[model samples]
Target: MTVLEQTGRRPAALAGLWGGLALTSGVALTATSGWLIVRAAERPVILTLLTAIVGVRAFGMARPLFRHLERLRSHDSALADLATARTEVYAALIPLTPARLGRRSRSAVLAGVVDDLTDVVESHVRVRVPVLSAGVAALFAILLTGALEPGAGVLVATWSALVVLLARWGLALEREAQPLLGAARAEVSRAAELVARHTPRLQAIGAAGDVLTRLDAAHTGLARALRTQSRGRALVTGGVLVLTGVTTVVMAVIAGRAELPSAVTALLVVVPAALADTVLPFADAVRAQARAEQSRAGVETLLDQTAAVADVGRGRQSSTAPHLRLEGVSAGWVEGRVDVGPVDLDLAPGRRVGVVGANGSGKSTLLAVLARALDPASGRYLVDGRDVTELAADAVRELLAVVDDEPHVFAADLRANLALAQPDASDQDLVDALRVCGLESWFDALPDGLGTRIGSGGRGVSGGERARLALTRAVLSRRPVILLDEPVAHLDHATATSVMRDVWAATSGRTVVVVSHRHEGLDAVDQVIDLTPTRKD
Candidate 1:
C-alpha cells in the first residue's frame, strides 16, 4: 500500500482542505469578477478598484500556497526523518541480506527515491494547486452562465473534462513506474553494496574500472527510462494544452461579440483561461504520485522487513558470560551448510574465551551467535540463564560490542570512531580508549587530531590501524561483552601482541570472545573454545 493509504488520514485531509479552500476562493473570485464586469459598464472607475483588490488578494494567497508547499518539500526535519527511517530499515535487513539485488529492483528504488519520491512531493502540491484553482475557475464559469450567458457553463465543463482526462493519464504513469522503479532501486543499491564490500578485492584484480563501467551503464539505463517517461508525459500534456488554448481563444472571441452585459461577457471570457491553467497542474500531480509510489515501495519494503531476529532478541538481559549459553544451535551459510552446534557451551562475565577454528569452521558464526548478530535456525541461545532469544534487541546489542574480522569503519574522523560507542563521551574517555587500543601514537601524528577523515575503505589508514580503531569503538561502546572475530589478524608480531594486551586489559571486566586461527595474541582469555576440525569432529 502507498504511504498515504497506510496513514489513511492525510489524503482526505489534504484533498478536502485544499480543494475546499480553493473552491471557496473560486466562489469569492467569481462573485467579484461578476461585480467588476457589471460595474465596469456604468462606473468605469470601479474596474480599477476591483482590479487592484483582486491583484492584492491573489498575491496574498500565493504565500499560503508557497508555505504549504514548503512544509511538503525539502524541509530539513522531514529529510532527516526520512534518512533515519532509511537507516533503520537498512539496519533491520542486515540479517537476511540477499547475495545480490536484482537489476530491475535496483533501478526501481533509485527511480523511486531520487525520482519517484520527489515526484510525490511535487504531486501533492500539484494535486492541491489544480484542485484549488480549477474549483475557483469553475465556480466563476458556472455563475457567469446564469448571470452573463450559457456559454460560460459549457466552457467550464469542457475545461473540467480536459482536466479529468489528463489526471487519469498521470495516475496511470505513476502506477506503472512503481514496480519497475522498485526492482531497479533494489538492484542499484545491491550493486553499490557489492562494490563497497569488495572494493579491495576488485582493486587487487584490477577490476574497479570494469565495476564502475557497469554501475555507470546501469545508472544510464535508469536515467533513460525516467527521461522517456517524462517526454511521453510532456507530449501528452502539450497536445491537450494546445486544444485547451484553442477553446479558450474561441470563448474570448464569443464573449467580445455577444450582446450580454459587459460584466457577464468578461466572466465568460476570463473563466476558461483560469480554469485551463488550474487543470494543467493535475498533470504534474499525477507524475509526482507515481514517483511517490515507487519511493514509498523502496522505503516501506525495507521498513516492513523489521527482522524477526530483532524482535526475538527483545526479551531479557544478563550479567555474565557463563550465564550465556548455546544449546543445539544449527544454521546454514548461503542457504544450506549446517555449521555448528547441537554442541553446548557456557561463558560467564569477566571471562575471556577464544574460539579457534580452521577456515570455513563455525568459529565466526559461534561468536555471532554469542554476540546476538545471527539468529540460529533452531535451538536456544541464552544470556544469563534467561533465553537471550527472548531479550530485547536493543538490550542485547548494547550488551555485546563486536569487532569482527571484517570490521566496518564509518566514514567519519578518528575521534568520532571511538565516540560512536558513547556519543556523549568525554574527551578523557576517548583518550582512555585510544590509549588502550595503542592508537595514541597514530592520533598524535594527525594534523586535525580527532577530526581527520578516514577516507573510503579506511584508505588513509592501515588494516592493523583500522582493526585497532574498531576495537577502540567497541571499548568505547562500554558493553558487558566484546566479540572479536580476529582482533590481531594482520598486525606484525609486536603490534598484534601489544594491541591484544591493551585490548584484553581494557576489557578486563567484561566477557570477551575472540575468534582466530592463530592464538598467540590472546593468552589473557580465561578459556579457549576451539571449533577446529579435530575438536569438533
Candidate 2:
C-alpha cells in the first residue's frame, strides 16, 4: 500500500493554487513598486500615482492573505493524509510483530519504523508543496514577461529550467550519498552501543582502547559522509544564485532595448529578481525528496516479508481446561534453520511445566510455539486433541497468556493497565485479580487505589511489582494456559522465588509452562524439562 498522500490530491492542489496566488502577489508587488517609484520620479499625474499606490497596497495585502489560506489548507490536508498513511503502515506491521522483527530489541526496530513512516508522510509538505508552488510562480513569471518582451520571457524560462536541472543533479548526488551515509551512521551507532552496553566487558578484556579506536574511526567516517551529502545542497544553492543574477542582468538589458515606457521597463527588469524567491527553495525540497525516497525504501524493505505464522484456519475454541501438546516441534525465526525443538511434551489441564536450558537452547522459542506465536517447522502442536494449525492463530492465542521478561505497563491508572486483558472486567474483578497476584499490599498503599497512575511518566514500579502486574493480567485474561518465558528473569533470587509463588497461586487450575535460563523458581514446577539443543547433521 502506498503510504504517500494519493487520495488528498484535490486538497493539495487547492493548497498549491493558494500558494501560487501568494507568490504571484509578491511578484506583482515587486514589479508595481518599481513602476510606482519610476513613475513618481518622472513627475507623473497625481491620478496615475494614486492608482499605483492602491495597486501596491492591494498586492501587499493579498500576499499575506493568500499565504494564510495556503497554510491552513496545506497543513490540514497533510495532517489528514499523514493520519491515514500511519494507520495503513501500522496495520501492515501488526502481523510481523515480535517474531519477524529479528533478534534485536523490539523497541529499536519499531522506533526505526515509526521514524521512516513519518519521513514518508512528510514528503507531501516538504517536497510536493515547494515543487508545485515554484511551478506556478515560474509559469506566471514566464508568461507575464513574455507578453511584454519575448526575449525576457525566454530568459526567465531558461533560468527556471537551469534551476530544475541543478535540482535534479543535486537530488542525484544526495541519493548517491544516502547509502554511504546510512552505513557510516549505523557504524557509529554500533560502536557507541557497544561501548555503552559492554564497557566493563571490553575493559576487562583489555580491549577498551581498540573499541575506542573503532569508535573514533566510525565517527570520522560519519563526518566524511556528511560532508559528501552537503555538496548537493551547496551545488543547488550556489548554482541557483549565479543563474538568478545572470537572468536578472539579462532581463535589464532586454527591458532597456525594448520600446516599453520607462516605468514598464523598470517593472520588467525587476520581475526576475522577484521570482528568485520562488526558485531558491528548490534546494531544500530536493533534499527532502531524496530523504523521503530513502525512508520509503527502508520501510518497504523492513516490511516486505510474509508473516512468520499464518492465521488462516477456522476460529476454533477449546474447552475450559485445554490440553496443550508439542510433539517434535522444531521452528526457527529464519527459514531453513531450526532454532528450537524436535522435542515432545504434553500439558494436561492444571499441569505446571518448567523449561530450563542454556542461552541458545531455545527455551523462549519453545514457549512461543506453545503460545501459537510461532508455527513448528516439523511436528505437531496440538490443542485439545486438535492440531493447532487447523485453528485460527488468534483463537489459539486467546486460550493462552504468555508473559516475557519485560512487561510493559502503559502510562495510565492502575485499573486501566489490567483492564486491557479483560476489557469488560468490573472493578471487583480487577481488585480480586490484583489481590490474588500478591499486589494487595501494593494496591492498598496507592493513594487512589485503582485510579493510581503507573508506568512511564507515572508512578514507578519495582521489578517484583512489574512481574506481579503481568500475572494479574494473566489472571484477568482467564486463559486456560499460562506461558511464562523468563517472566521473573530480571528479579533477584528471593524476589524471583516470591513472584513465582504468586504466579503459581494466581494461575491455579490453569495449564502453565515457564521457560527460564536461570534456575530461580524451577523447584515449584510439577515437571522440569531440561532442553539441550541437538546437533544438526
Candidate 3:
C-alpha cells in the first residue's frame, strides 16, 4: 500500500482545512485591496469607504496568519506519517533482510528505500495539501464571480480548467522523468558511498581515478535527469503567468461591456492576478506527485518480495548449545541462479569451520544460508538434527551471532555500542569481551573508557579497530554459534591473522564459521571448506 493511504485521515483533513483557509485568505486579500483602491479613487466619503478599508486590513492579516497555521498543521501531519511509515517499512524488511535485499550494493538499495520513504511521506505536504487548498480557493473564486455576473463566473471556471490542464501536462512530463531521476540518484549514492568508504584502498591499488571517473559519470547523469525534470515545472510556471495575464484582460473587457461599477470591475480584473499564487504551486505539486509515485512504486516492489525463508511455526527452541548440519545444500540468492554449495557439512557443538572461495564462488552465500538469512533451495539444513524449516526462524536465529564486514557502529557511547549485542551485559563483561577481541589497548586509550562516544561525530576508529569492535560484539553476545563473513576483510594480513587468533581464543567453546576469500585466518579453523568451482567432466 502507498504511504499516503496509510497516513491518518484526521490530520490530513485538518491540514486541508487550514490550507484552504490560507489560500482563500490570499484570494480575498487581493480582491479586497483592489476594490478598496478603486472605491477610494471615486472620491467617496471616508465613512462610505470604512467597510472596505477594514476588509482589506482583515484579509491582509488573515492571509499570513492562516498560512502560518496551514504550514504547522501540514508539516506536523507529514512528520507523524513519516514516523509511522518508517516503522512499518523497517518491520517489513526484517524477513527479507540480507537475502532478498540483493547480493551486492545492499547498502545502496537500503539507502534508496530511506530516500523513497521520505519522498512518499512528503507528498502529503507538498502535493495533497496544496492541491486541496488551491481547489478550495478556485471554487470560492468561481462562486464569488458567479454571484457578481454569470458570464464572469463562466470565464473564471474556464481559466481554472486551463490551469488544471497545464498542471496535467506538467505532471505527465515529470512522470516520464521520475524513473530516470530516481535511478540516477541511486547510482550516485552507490558510487559516492563506495569511494567514501574505501578511498584509501582504491588509492593504494591505483583504482582511485577509475572509481572517481565513475562517480563523475553518475553525478552527470543525475544532473541531466534533474534538468529534464525541471523543464515540466518551468513550462507550468510560465503557463500559469501567461494564462493569468490573459484572464485579467478578458475580465476587464467583460466588466467594461457589462457596465459594472468601477469597484466591482477592479475586483474582477484583480481576481485572476490574486489566484496566481493558488494556481502557480500546481507546477511544484505535480512534480512532487510524480516523485511520490515513483518512490511508492519502489518501496512497494521491495516490500512485496516473498521472504527468502518462511516461518513454519514456533518450532523447537534449543535449551543447550546447538549443532548445525547442511546436507547436499545448494542455495541461490536470486531465484534460478545457484550461488553456493551442493555439498555436505557438519558442525557439532564448538566446532570451528572456515569457508574460503574466490569471488562468485558463494562463500558469503553459504554463510548466509548457515546464518539462516537464506533458506537452502535443495538441501536439508538441520539444527540439532531438526530441520530448520520446521523450527521457528527466530528460534534458530537466536542461536547465532553474526559479524559481517560492514558492521555498523552506531553514533553512541562505547558501552552502548557493545551493549546492543548483549543488553544485559555488565560494563565489566563488556570490557572483558573487548579485551578478548584484541581491543584492550584501544579500550584503555579511550578518554572515558567505556563511556567514550564513538561512531559518527565521535572518536575516529581505524579499519582494524572497527573489525575488532564487531568481533567484540559477537563475543559479548555469547551465542553458541557465531558466523563471521569476512569480519577481518578490511584489515592487513598481520592484523587479520592477529584478530583471528583473538577470535579463536574468545570463541574457544562456541560453534563458529568464518567465511573469507583471504587465507590469513584459516590457520585457526578446525576444518576449511573450499568452494572454488572444479570441472567434473
Query: Which candidate has the top score in lDDT?
Result: 3
Local distance difference test values of all predictions, in order: 0.64, 0.86, 0.88
- In model 2, what is the error at residue 478, expressed in angstroms? 2.3
Write one digit per residue (lDDT tens) for candidate 3, span 1-537: 755476846676677778888899889888988988998898998999888888878988887888888889888888888898988888888999887776456666777788989999888888888888888899999999999988899999999999989999999999999989878987998899889989999999999999999999999999999999998999899999999999999999999999999999999999999899897888889998898898898889888999998777578775568878999999998889899989799999989999987889999889889888898989899888889988989999889999998888889999999999999999999989988888988888999999999999999988888988888888888799999999888788888888888888889899999998888868878899999999799
lDDT of 2 by residue, 6-103 (tens): 64577778888888899999998998999999989999678979988999999999999999998898889877877887788787777787688876
Q: Which candidate model has the greater lDDT, 2 or 3?
A: 3
Backbone clashes, each candidate? 39, 0, 0
Tell me each candidate's TM-score: 0.72, 0.95, 0.93
Query: In candidate 2, how many Å is residue 377 off?
Result: 0.7
The lDDT of model 1 is 0.64
- By lDDT, the candidates rank as 3, 2, 1
Residues 143-200 of candidate 1 have per-residue lDDT tens digits of 6553565665676666667666766765776677656655665556666876987999
**What RMSD value applies to candidate 3?**
2.6
Better of 1 and 2 by TM-score: 2
